[model samples]
Target: MTAEIGPPKSANPEIVRRYARLLREHGDAFNVTDNQTAIVRMSSFASALICLQEGAEPIMQMTCRDRNRIALQSDLLGASALGVRNVLCLSGDHQTFGNQREAKNVYDIDSTQELQMFKMMRDERRILGDDELEEGPKMFLGAVENPFADPFEFRVARLAKKVSAGADFVQTQAVFDMERFERWMSAARDRGLDRKVHIIAGVVPLKSLGAANYMKKKVPGMIVPDHIIERMRKATDAKSEGIRICVEQIEHLMTIKGVHGVHIMAVNWEEKVPEIVEKANLHPRPPP
Candidate 1:
């Protein structure tokens, strides 16, 4: 029989501990952010606390855009110490999308390098040069993919590289165009990547007309159909309609074969996750 894999752990330490306890008690998957802005703003920590409180396993995302090598290593160390066993490393969103325009951008290490660093820490129990008495964090490293990005070939190549770099799993960008996403997944599988990594589809719920428009105009590669937009416009309450649309979209994606799981980008709409899970019938897999 195939071994059953639980949901990825959250990167936030506090959430890690909470989810660790949850998995120990009741098993449920809780998701969290990897964006620097969210981390700095303490939303990452806050969500981690929620995961712990609810006894839910969390999948934490870590990005390279906010911290230098030293800071990044420090955070990783802290997370491991706090029992954070899963990490989704990312290069992070560009500075322009964030609040601090004047702040310096730190790309000291990209996601692939970060994954390699995590692998080294797990295998060596210490950084490459520093041989110290440290218990390395055992992290399930994950990466992100933007199937809609230009030069589709390049995106696939980068994904293969990330898997080679040490990524155990991958979560894709918000998937609006299912056909395009399926094509990318097919190509990835043909490249021998599908067998190596567990791919979780990313789903973000549209909150308002403005939100839809911003994603379409500002967030490159996120394409929402005109029909979805029209539905949002016709709804009596935009927020309610947005949630309904999210549920519908998630349900549709869940039916597609080859998708391991759905990573919902609630974006502060945490309360709605349980609803989506129920609507999609996503239950915790039995432990092996």
Candidate 2:
């Protein structure tokens, strides 16, 4: 499983270490988000290094929203020198949603282009402008997709494009609508996209009725079915019910084709991850 962890707002090494240790105990690799939601936080690179020091593998997420191509390339070189192996390229959330509304966004290149650059850097030992490097970043590249997004027929096609662009693996947005996810997976399998890349499905445990509602109505590119919301509403202990539902989802996800693994995103309720993993019988994670 890939555990998603956000760095704290300030430089708090101890907090990072605590969460990294927790996730490493129950997860194969923990993902350090890059300024998630376009809000500022500790840099993903520093938090990832803390994870590495704590003996945990990190999937460092890099977004195109904040950095230019020159900075992106420089960061990649630094990450490689520092032994950060896994990288997930993303077109991040808009600055409007973030606290720093005045920030000027940069989309120097989209996520697909970034993936191509990473592939070239690794396979060809060349950066942009055809400049040769003494050594390229030996990275296991990743990308993200939203199967729940509209224009549903195109989701799998988009995934195929990312694979063609050199994504070694792809993690999808949270799956609240399983039927849609199943259909998407079926299409992916038909296109043999699953064989080309590892597909890690996303699953989030709803912490409250309000949280469910926000995702259902507020979050763009999110599709939370009415049934899920109703489940959250009718539950007595929403948190416990949420965890149970998440465990069930993970179990059900295992039976689906083309689902390589699950990314359990317990946002702020991260301490509950071990319980979820144990209840789902995914504990005793294999070694790195």
Candidate 3:
């Protein structure tokens, strides 16, 4: 399984290194967030470099929200120079939701276009302007998909678009509604999208009932089932209950045909990752 970790709000390499070392014990890769929620933080590139320094494989996330094509390309080239090999492309959260509302958004290209650009840079050794590169970034491309989103039937088609644009792997939005996630997976398999790319299911280990409620009500593309909330509500130890639920989700995801792996997004509860990984029988990951 993989684990997604966010950088500190300000500059703090030690914190990033600590998380990287802790998570690397059980996860195959560490996915560093790129100004997630559109809120400013340490750059994903720097955090990913910290992961690398901590002896972990870093899946650096890139968003099209803050930078134009030229700037994005420059960052990718920098990543190449730094030896970071994995990247997750995203359209990112809107600027209005972030602290910098006055900041002009630069979505010169959407996520799919970003993927195409990165893929071209890697495969064809070229940039957006078709300029030849002495050595293009050799990256394993990834994209995000929210199966819980509305117009559910079109989610798989959306994933297909990313695959066609050259996403090597796909990490889904956190899975709380198993029924819907399974249905989406089934559809992806039906269209043979699963065959084209590795699908890593996302799971969040809730810390309390309040977190569950918040996710259910506030998160735009998330769907937290009432049953899960009720379970959390009745649990005497909410944190442990959340871990149990996350482990169960990981186990269940393994049974799904198209799921290649699980992405544990423990958020602030990063220390519990090893416990959850062991409980889910994903510990001592196979050697690369």
What lDDT tens digits, residue by residue, belong to model 1 across residues 1-288? Answer: 001112223444553453345333222344456544422454443454455455555556667887777777777777766666677788887776666777788999898888887777877776746675357877788888899888887888989999988888888888777788888888887887878888778787778888877777777767777777788788889888887887777777666656676777666454455556655555444653
Model 1 regions lying over 4 Å from their true place? 1-27, 34-40, 43-50, 130-134, 284-288
**Which segments of model 2 are wrong by more than 4 Å?**
none
Per-candidate local distance difference test: 0.68, 0.93, 0.93
> Quick one: how many clashes does candidate 1 have?
7
Question: What C-alpha lDDT, on a 0 to 100 scale, does residue 45 get in candidate 3?
Answer: 94
lDDT of 3 at 75: 95
Could you tell me the lDDT of residue 125 within candidate 2? 95
lDDT of 1: 0.68
**What is the lDDT, from 0 to 100, of the residue 55 in candidate 2?**
83
| Error at 196, model 3, angstroms | 0.7
lDDT of 3 by residue, 1-288 (tens): 899888989887999989888888799888999998888999999999999989889999999998989998999999979989899999999988888889999999999999999999999999987899999898999999999998998999999999999999999999999999999999999999989999999999999999999999998889999999999999999999999999999999999998999998888888899999999988898876
- Residue 50 miss distance in model 2 (angstroms): 0.8
Candidate 1 displacement at residue 110 in angstroms: 0.7
**Residue 256 error for model 2, in Å?**
0.8
Residue pair clashes in candidate 3: none
